[model samples]
Target: MKMKKVQEILEAHIWAGEEDLEGEVYAACGCDLMSDVLAFAKEKVLLLTGLVNPQVIRTAEMLDIRAIVFVRGKEPSKEMIEMANHKGMIILSTQEPLYMACGKLYAAGLMCESED
Candidate 1:
């Protein structure tokens, strides 16, 4: 799915990398555990998490994830945003909780890596 569509599906607000809104993501993963992300996320995946920390950005970077959706109204820190911007990754935040956000994206045809 296009990042813009994902944003719309989740009612998300872009926090950084607005230029990446047109990018494509083949899969989505909702996880608070970075280890789970490392183990399962594929290239260009959309990461949905409620954890607000710099480590999230680092994990996404290592996995080549281009977009991240912060659920439950969680916001990334200034340093995290800067790190994401430096890495050219798009960051989005939504008021919905993690499960609901993931479901909405899935219903919109954005499947998980395993489903893909």
Candidate 2:
């Protein structure tokens, strides 16, 4: 899915990277544990989490994640946003719960790395 499609599917609001919304996302990973993000996510995948911390952005940076989705209406801190901006990562916030958001995207053909 492309970033624009992801935003539409999750009903997410883009907090950054308006110009990069056309970027493509082949897979997704959902986790709140930053350590897990470091340990597992693959390249060019979108991260879905409820955690709103700078570490989340750092995790994305380390793994070269293209975008992040904050589920359950959560939003990141200003520092986190700045961190992601510096890394050129797209940030999105959605009112949908984590499971529902993941399900909706998965049903729309965005698979997890394990499924790939």
Candidate 3:
């Protein structure tokens, strides 16, 4: 799915990297645990999390996951946004909680890929 579709599906507001909205995401992973994200995230995956921290950006960067949706209306700090901007990542925020956000994306055909 395209990042633009993910934004529309989640009713998300782009906080950064709007220019990259055309980017394609092969899968989506909704998790707040950075360790799990590091372990399971695949290339070009969209990350959905309520954990608003720089570490999330770092984790996404490490995995080359370019788009992130901050669920439950959680917003990242200015510094975090700056960090994401530097990494050329798309930062989005939505009023939907993590579960609903994930479900909406899944319903929109953004399924997660199995590690196997």
Candidate 4:
């Protein structure tokens, strides 16, 4: 799924890296635990999370996640935004609950790529 498409799917607000919303996302991982995201996310993934912290961005950087969708209307911290911006990750916010957000993305064809 393209970042632009994901934004549209989630009806999200882009807070940064709006220029890169056209970037493609081949996989998605929904999680609040940064540790689990780091442990399991594959390449070219979009992270759907409610954990609003700087570490979220840092974890994304390490895992090469290109986008982050904050579920349940969560707003990331300023430090998180700055970190994500510096790393060129698209940051978005949506009012949908986590399960609904994940379901929408999944139903729209964004899936978790198998890691082997």
Best TM-score among the predictions, by candidate number:
1
Maximum-lDDT candidate: 1
> Please, what's the RMSD in Å of model 1?
0.7
What TM-score, computed on C-alpha atoms, does each candidate reach?
A: 0.97, 0.96, 0.96, 0.94
- The local distance difference test score of model 1 is 0.92
Error of 1 at 76 (Å): 0.6
* Model 2 lDDT, residue 51, Cα: 92
Select the stronger candidate by TM-score from 1 and 3. 1
**Per-residue lDDT for 49-80 in model 4, tens only?**
99988888888888788799999999988888
Per residue, candidate 3 scores C-alpha lDDT tens digits across 1-116 of: 98999998889999999999998998888898999999888887899999999999999998888889999999999999999999999999999999999888888888775533
Tell me the lDDT of model 1 at 50: 92
Better of 1 and 4 by TM-score: 1
| lDDT per residue as tens, model 2, 36-101 | 878888988999999998888877887889799999999888888777788899999999988899
Cα TM-score of candidate 1:
0.97
lDDT of each: 0.92, 0.89, 0.90, 0.88
Q: Which stretches of candidate 4 lie over 4 Å from their true place?
A: none
Better of 2 and 4 by TM-score: 2
> Model 3: runs farther than 4 Å from truth?
none
Model 4: per-residue Cα lDDT at residue 55:
86
Model 1 ranges off by over 4 Å = none
Clashing pairs for predicted structure model 2, backbone only:
none
